[model samples]
Target: MNKYLELALLFAFVLAETVGMWRIFSKCGRKGWLAAIPMLRRYQMGLCAGRDAEGRQLALLESGVAVGIFSCIFFKTGSVSYMVAAFLLLLLIIPYTIFSIRVYFGLCDAFGRNRFWVVPWVLCDWLCALIWGFGSDFKTAEGYPFDDEDAAPEVSGIEADLTAPGLSINITRRTAMSLFKRKVLLRDIHLIIPMGHMVLLLGGSGSGKTTFLNAVTGYEKANAVITLGDSNVYKEYNSMKYDIGFVPQQDLVRGSDTVYRTLSDAASLRLPADMKSDKRRERINEVLDTFGLTPVKSSLVDKLSGGQRKRLSIAMEYISDPTLFILDEPDSGLDGVMARALFEKLRVIANSGKIVIVITHTPDRVADLFDDVVVIAKDAKRTGRLAYYGSVYDARIFFGKKSMEEILMSVNRREEGGEGRADEFVRKYSALAAGGEV
Candidate 1:
């Protein structure tokens, strides 16, 4: 072959390698820079792998050795051993491809490992690369802006509630009091979350949006009630908990299991005994596709990136088909687009007759997605009082000049102010008696 042709072939190998690497990195929720360096990327993959470090390392070493041997065989035989090496290379390549597709495309992140485990993948790839030396330009590490609607439709089962706005949620202060002792964080507050709407709860610091959801979910004990479907949820605490599927602000997935294994185990424990694996998988596929987890379906749970982990966490809650799903601070650290997509995802969930409630610090740019609006005062006592409950589309008219976050803050301040008024006056008197500043 001519020199140019050899160069082109090598370039193609590198291209495929690059694309493959991009795919993995993309799903990992990591920076693109790491995928450029092979060895370094391996270590980075380990970091994301959590406890799988040794297994991952061995896989890489074995695969590396295999690829090296494969190359040497090609140099020596010059015959049809090339095909055998190619097949071996694919043993590794196939998983990488799957990872690329699932992590980057399906799960919307790069953490998806495409096999029974990462260790095997590492070994398989090393063997393939050593033997074939095809030098195909496969690459990994890619990214796309976070998307919800555009992602594979996991459910097609859950629909967004777009009917007339009657959705409202009320989280109240005594509700806040029910959360922790000492003093209430923010008073009770109510939100009229329309049937198929995406509402953002905005607040700064101790504004209490999260606290509100806890009360709503019965995660915390409350002196008062939270209402959904116009019924006092607190009154039906045990039953209501099941009605609302929650994705907490923190990672709740137990470490030490692959994504599929963990979810499957959960299905086994939580699902009915008669559920078949195939049918269960079909539902799992819907969620995986919706959340873009199909790529790293076989990946270790600990290997997922922040974004991928977040998406996976969200996916875990919906498998049971909840009626009202509540997400606390779903957009906490996310950018605008992901936040919007989060809303879209919730919208899709709500449309299925189940209500979707998302609490955040701001509810801007998604006004059209809301069916109802509920605002709480800053005081745990006042805010938790189930203040304004109306159509979210009309929120502009109801809560004028105040953003959702600002309203939460104001209510929080009012609650704190009330508590301050109740006790601080005594504190001031004591300070004055002791000749300190009033």
Candidate 2:
């Protein structure tokens, strides 16, 4: 109860926790010194428990909170009120507690402890760390679930048909940095889509759908070969850029510009630099008619309806008359009838021999329009892997689901309220790609 005794107890607790964390880090194959650092210690602990994502976030929150506390102390003599500092600290602590609890639970899992261990880890973390760190019985479990060494399947799938006249993507792996560590976004995605087929790019949240598209379009080059109609996309992005039409979810047209002017401006940017004005105008008119914007050519973009605005956006991209067309949620914010009509237009483009790939949340609404489907799923390590790539009917049979939405559910994680068969499907598809039966 004495102030000196309280100080002594606090110092001892800190020393015990630090020593325990250091030992835990060493056991987890990390440097023991990491436990001594303020923010880095929290992050390293997250990694030890296989919750790297939450760990990185927790480190950031901890850093922010420390900075806020320091500022409050430094400015105590200034106009800064204690009540404001208290409220600010409370706001940060709520989320901080949530993230810390998750990391603690992950630590419990890593050390082969039950959820009940989280209670002591939260209330008396120093003691828990000492017990788990130095106890003879406490050791990291073998075959940890979050181990990523064998995360990717060895199945390379079918070889890309470079001679085939369509979009061919053979991404070995797409990686990016996360908290100073390399993280894989996608891996072992190899498939060749033939010309004139409308392919649906299906994946749940964080499944790398957009990243795959960016790789295909050469916007973000991955470590793989991508061929589009006999041209290497990464090697010949300058020329291939014109041949790939990408309609993003949001329209970028100006409100003051009329539909005709919008297309004309797009034509100037998308069309060949050497093209004559007359020829460019002719091509713009064709695109205007193709997307059904001819009637509203003189209408201001702001005055256009949702469907009309969406069409204009497509027309702007279509002004290039690309051989490979890709749309990210082209029907977003449109009603059922409008979405169906939009997909019908895409079908027409495919009918004209252009490769069409689309990503839509409501794929079942226009399932009949797509010729093939490319399903991507995140494996246990959270890296996107190819789950299925074939006809729509075949996808139904492969996933054993009746609809596209159901197929998505089948590959989603169990926590997402669906079958957690992503790794299963990835292996099956790999075997199928190697000329073996699933």
Give candidate 2 misplaced runs (Cα > 4 Å). 1-15, 22-40, 48-50, 57-128, 131-158
lDDT of each: 0.53, 0.88
Number of the predicted model whose TM-score against the real structure is largest:
2
Model 2 scores worst on lDDT over the 10 consecutive residues at 145-154
Expressed as tens digits, the lDDT of each residue in 1-438 for candidate 2 is 554575577678878988999999988889999888878888999999988888888988888777666555545444647557766877897888889899998988888888898888888989988998899888887776454433446455566777777888899889998775798899989899999999999999889999999989999989989998879999999889999999997987799999999899888888889999889988988888888889999999999999999999998888888999999999899999999999999999999999999999899999999999999998888889999999999999988889999999988877778687888899888888888978
Give lDDT: candidate 2, residue 420. 77
Per-model TM against the reference: 0.48, 0.80
Clashing residue pairs found in predicted model 2: none
TM-score of 1: 0.48
Candidate 2 Cα deviation (angstroms), residue 231: 1.0
